[model samples]
Target: MTAIYRSAAGAAAVRDRYDTLLDRWPVPSGRRTVRTRLGATFAVVSGPVDAPPVVALQGSGGTAAHWLPDIATLAGRLRVYAVDAPGEPGRTAEARPPLTSPAYAEWLDDVLDALELPRAAFLGTSLGGWWALDHALRRPARVTALALVNPAGIGRRRIAPLLKFAGYRLFGAWGRRRSLAMVAKGSPADPGRRAVGEFTFATFEHFKPRLEAIPVVPVERLRTLAMPTQAHFGAHDVLLDQRDAAAKLREAVPHADVRLAEDAGHFLPGWAGSVVTFLEGERS
Candidate 1:
């Protein structure tokens, strides 16, 4: 396990560098606003209003900034709205409710109402993917399409390997950095890797506390989803077993199309072109 510098100065430096990079390569031109609801102000990042809408939900401890890499690639064809999940960091006002699947679905509906987007395609990664799936099940008519990138909440309950658990406990910060590094290496888009990694890492840092409060999804509820779903998992993902996650999703959404990215990891959307092609082809 690598040691993370615990000093205030070190943390500050890390934060400053992260902010600088975010400012330089901001998510393609969009509107930013806070929607006050349930004692929280959820931050909303919206692209062109005239285009077909696609809402992006970032993973646990991840922010809207993580989707910037795929923004331009997706925005050309659709209006992209990246939402900062409440209770997590990065622009959203924090008033965290108990992190349950149903609660998340309700909150997402509120966000859509605030944005005035009656129906839109939903794209998500990891924990965000879990919420998106649950949201689709709860409001099938509101979601036109579903795209999940290495989504969580699909596997059975079991403790992670001892060594991996120990590493996460002892070197949580360093482990996050290493994971971001791996994401950068696995990403197919070269120019966006470093920028996206920095953004994702910073988001992880900011949302660490809130993330711990959320529980994994229950396996029994997986069968409820009925959307035209497209899920992608990295063959070599370190967090959740790719094969297990994919299998569970297949069992849940029997008709959904599932694909595997041979060399990718949890950060599947960094391989934007493939994802875009899959969405376009599947929709067509």
Candidate 2:
């Protein structure tokens, strides 16, 4: 059995917690299990049946449940598919594909194929942003639009945040919470956000995360994305060089809409409205 948790019990605990959050999903939603070459992928589907489709990807070590706060607003306009990527702490396969290859884009191709979507927009955060960007670069024809939040693979990687996180780990649970709070700045103070935060803490308590270097998307390739693209960066983010990332993206794709939030960090909360507006505009 493929698992990202330290033990089977840990996996069950995470799943149970995730399920509980889904039970409180502010809007009507359903689960989707799509077969792909990488493995069986899972997505929490929301929105109207006839609405424009958008596939959402979460950050590393996160699941679809993390998107609960945004679903109600997002599903109000377009069809939303919050996908749990392979190798992450979700129901997806535990196949850790190499970051340097085209495997991820191909896996996404299979997902789109199974979903029967000829074209769709994409919403991704951090590692998920990198995956969506990779797919857009590899298959520009299929992506209608792009929405990235504190995405990786744009600027040079820094070691300070990783080292700081390591130091926090030495102090045990208290330190871990500090690490999460420090890294995930600007999380909204809402009930759904709180539930997600609790679930995140529980997940990291027993889950093992990927340690490989996140691959950077070459700046030149950014020009190939003819589709509408909007990227949001948090100025306080410690995990990535958000300023440099935003600069490079603006330089490469001059037409791209990029925003840098001075008060936000890597985890952007309370910004779902802007994302929904962007995606909804694309449909018209």
Candidate 3:
């Protein structure tokens, strides 16, 4: 099951929280642009030009801001381009059409083309991870490396009922607080909880469209991807059973490196030092 955030009031609260967080930990220095194509607008945040390039994609209903925590750690090592998914909210604003997996691949390709990046490492979480892997398969030459954190869509495992539970239809101030508490349960670190809450609430406000638009890539297709890939999944992921998902991923992308975080959940990237180490190791 997918949760879509779409109440006007709820959106505002989320926006406020995101803005506040950005204010506190501003991007060191970079360029921000609004790229438009196919009637969709994408907000692109680019860091140092000479650094190794990486494009970060967030999960379903999430925006580019979902990467802020990692961005702080990765920007210096790579020219990170975090894109506000066209269909989700944040800087991107457009009436998105119903998108299939292929359409999503094309959209990401367009974003890369617009940025004039010949090749880049792709990092994604949950739905974003699925998209990253799909993109790699669609244009193997364009991807240098791929990293997925507690990603979704690798198998048929069901998400835990608690993680799927949202107290309100749309998260307002109270909903945000409650949602944060739920997210905190999966995250081991305090900073991780704060970052997850901010990102989740923002997603709740801006993204619109049916959850089904995010396609589940079958195991057969995954086996064909040739990019250098590393996937991390929490042992206790509430959204998807890691053991089954990891096994399927291994069968499909036999060459891909997979890591299991024993104490984490679906929100593994927010775990600070651990994720930083993972990214650093993969980059090396």
TM-scores, in order shown?
A: 0.78, 0.95, 0.81
Cα distance off (Å), candidate 2, residue 98: 0.2
TM-score leader: 2
Stretches of candidate 1 off by over 4 Å are 1-22, 25-28, 39-48, 156-179, 182-185, 188-191, 202-207, 210-220, 269-271, 274-284
For residue 158, model 1's alpha carbon misses the true position, in angstroms, by 7.9
Tell me how far the alpha carbon of residue 176 in candidate 3 is from the true structure, in angstroms, after superposition: 4.5
lDDT by residue (1-284, candidate 2, tens digit) is 34567988988888887888778888888899999999999998999988889999998888998788778888998899999999988788888878998899999999999999888999998899999999999998889999999998997777887788777777887887787788768866677776676677668777888888998878888878888999999988888889999999999999999999998988787667888888888872
lDDT, candidate 3, 143-249, per-residue tens:
87888887777755464543445444355776766655554455756574467555665465455544453456788788887877788888876667777888888
User: All models: lDDT?
Assistant: 0.65, 0.86, 0.66
In what order do the candidates fall by lDDT, top score first? Answer: 2, 3, 1
Scored against the true structure, residue 138 in model 1 reaches a CA lDDT of 77
By lDDT, the best candidate is 2
Error of 1 at 213 (Å): 7.2
